[model samples]
Target: MIFQNRSRCRENKSIFRAGNQVLQHTHEYTYLGLKLSSTGNFNLAVNELKAKAMRVFYMIKNTIRHEIPIQTWLKILQAIIEPIALYGSEIWGPLKTQDFSKWKKEAIETLHTQICKSILKVNRATPNNSCRAELGQHPLLINIQKRAVKFYQHLKRSDPSSYQAEALRCQEQNRPRSTLSQLMLKLQPDQHSTIWPNQIIQLQKLNDITYWKDATKSQKKMELYLNLKRDYKPAEYLSCVKEHKVRKTLTRYRLSAHCLAVERGRHRQRWQPRERDCVCVCVCVCVCVCVCVCVCVCVCERERERVSECPLSGCRERTAPAEVAAERERLCVCVCVCVCVCVCVCVCVCVCV
Candidate 1:
């Protein structure tokens, strides 16, 4: 199949022969596990890779419980899944031009983030940057680009007489839209500069892998710390937690990914408040009522869902009964100005904070 931008040659029927037999012209072909199409579009190939990677990802996720350490999970992901997803990234990596490259990169990013969330036993709502920072993991795109850059470096350092080196030179000279050309454009090499620094060395210090990894992680963590400081929000609990480990746990709690959050969700799922007997029952039936300064009455019933408007003019906000079961419940009356507390009943506890 022809790999050109235009399909004018396709209109004319062409035939090829190999010895005594006729060679078939197929629209698509898979060679060395990488799919190639007549239109030269890499989207299909990327989709295939993502599908394979996801299958493996799920298998691993199901196989390994959260009992494993974060470092071990990271190792499994980087070793098993990344290789599958980024199999031919070195070849198609440069094709990721901004507006045209959303799905290609997003798929990999999603996989990486999901794995990270699973590793931390965090909720899906956690911010991607926070997860990456917590785990000290670089973005998957960086890894893919690094692979591409290293591949280029390898080709550059190959024997000049080798076909790969010859092809590299030829492509640089003739093919402006080629992978090498695109990578060079992205890199923005200086024309006036003669002496080229080793891309491999400049990209990362590989002589000591452990040191390099640690340094990279530290850099990432420092950047995250600076970002957090810039966007700081004072929390009461944070002031009390002086230990670094305790602060880390508090940060996770703030992000809604801590064990408390998980347990809260589980509790909500298990004990659903009846809609009819909802404490903030705006309409009719009295489920449970507590005679306090700020009275919260809930009439919770099975499979009932409706919005409960506050009868009191003081309480402008209206809450759903289903939400009262799933989330927090607020009082319709003016009980307290600033302080909010949780109330545990005889059967079910309506936790509001």
Candidate 2:
């Protein structure tokens, strides 16, 4: 038989009996300085964070009376306000927005926009997206996704059977429709083809903040260096990597002249008795090496003369002043080497024979 209304066993009014006292359930409670709702929503906590961020922003504005560099503000945001406002956000954000209630959804969106505006010093007239671009900051939504991705990368390499891993596995399998689940499913395949490695972002542990910051700075510097090198003219690169063209030509010419002299002496002694001939295995090797070097000298010198006007050799990119200087230097070297090699060879041949 069903219980009557008079039974006073209503779900809302239900009480539990302890050994000597009664315990009651409530809709809200405070845990670890954050409000916890019975329905497990964090709207109140987000609101509190937003208010605190506003207060901190004002405090920073008042503390600095002079025209301080943006770097100082950046350090404060990074060191204090950001951490305080985003303390527990990593737990809930970067997931599907559909899973959150309307209040939380609105609160998160507003929180990100307001925080961005405050930090970037942009008035309401300027577009938030443009402000983010100007400051080289990611959108609020993407920031959350970044954190989630960083955490996901860490958990992926952990022991599969451990508590955190098991929980994540379960969540992944059950929450396929979540924003993070769908995002990874869509992007994981593309990650293999990307230059960035999957494990590079696993710097999400508590103690890795300093390491991560330093690593980011280094990566940016490396990227800048690579870009500079890539766009630099081939002429500059040649100078950096190879010996001076004049020096190379001079060395080759000297060796070639010595070889020519030895060959010519052997030729002149050909009419004499075979026993008197100075030609030997060493002479033959020297002649061959001289011939090969002479041929190379001619070829390289001719190519440089032919392409003297083209600093890039074949490309159409405009040459820089440094590249022009480098080209002129190489040209001078090639001319000197070619002239030395040719004159020495002919003179040695005439003199020795």
TM-scores for all candidates: the values are 0.55, 0.44
Candidate 2 residue lDDT tens string, 1-353: 12223234435555567887978766567677676666556767777877887788778788877654444555676677766666566566653352211322456556555665564443444343333322334334444546666677778779988898987887788766455566555445465553233342332222133332343344422332233332211223223323344433432232222244442354364464544334543464466567657756766675556465555656545454565557666856766676676567655654443
- Tens digit per residue, CA lDDT, model 1, 1-353: 65657555665367778898988777778989988887887777887898898899789788865454455667788899899989898887677642212532476677787777766556776665556655666556666667776787789889999999999998888767576667655554663543333563344323223333344445433443444432212333444555646665766664545566443564464653676346443321132223342242332322122333423324436444465534443433233421233233322343431
Candidate maximizing TM-score = 1
Estimate every model's Cα lDDT from 0 to 1.
0.59, 0.52
Let me know the TM-score candidate 2 reaches against the reference structure: 0.44
**RMSD (Cα, Å) of model 2:** 26.9
Candidate 1 local accuracy as lDDT?
Answer: 0.59
Report lDDT (Cα) of residue 110, candidate 1: 78
Candidate 1, 79: how far from true, in Å? 2.0
Alpha carbon lDDT of residue 35, candidate 2?
Answer: 67
